[model samples]
Target: MSAELYDFQDKIAKIPEQEKKAFVLYDVLGYKYKEIAKIMDIKVNSVGVYIHRARTIFFEENDDSSCRSRRPMMSMVWRLVA
Candidate 1:
């Protein structure tokens, strides 16, 4: 993996357990929202909400105006690992 990917993974490893699991199931494992909800024992809507919140937190933590141009690529990786 690239350094950016490593950094993103490290950052995601620091988030809450539920958020990490929800994110990984949905993104990395390519599970549908309904499937993730069933697997996680949560409402389907809650799955979407958790992912949104997790994505927000990840972006906020990595925000840096000096690296604005890299945000898009980082955001893509964040989706995979968050």
Candidate 2:
């Protein structure tokens, strides 16, 4: 794996458990919101909220102004997973 991908995963590993699980299920595992909601026992809408919050927190924590411009963290994550 690339260093950037590894760093992204490491950052994700450091997030709160709820957000981490939601992010992994939805983004990494390609699970639907309803399915994620069932797995998490949260409302369907809450699944979207969790994913959004997770992405925001990930970019905030991982942003590096020196190396590159800030881009959507999910885009990088998708490259890793795909």
Q: lDDT score, residue 28, model 1?
A: 55
Candidate 1 structure lDDT: 0.71
Looking at model 2, which ten-residue stretch has the lowest summed lDDT?
A: 65-74
Tens-place lDDT per residue, model 2, 1-82, is 8898788877787678888888778866778899999999999999988877776777675456342222344466667778
Give the Å shift of residue 12 in candidate 1: 0.7
TM-score for each candidate, following the candidate numbering:
0.66, 0.66
**Candidate 1 per-residue lDDT over residues 1-82, each given as its tens digit:** 6777787777687768888788767655668899999999999999988876666666676566453233454466666566
lDDT of each candidate versus the true structure: 0.71, 0.74
lDDT of 1 at 18: 87
Off by over 4 Å in 1: 61-82
RMSD to the hidden true structure, all candidates:
5.7, 5.0
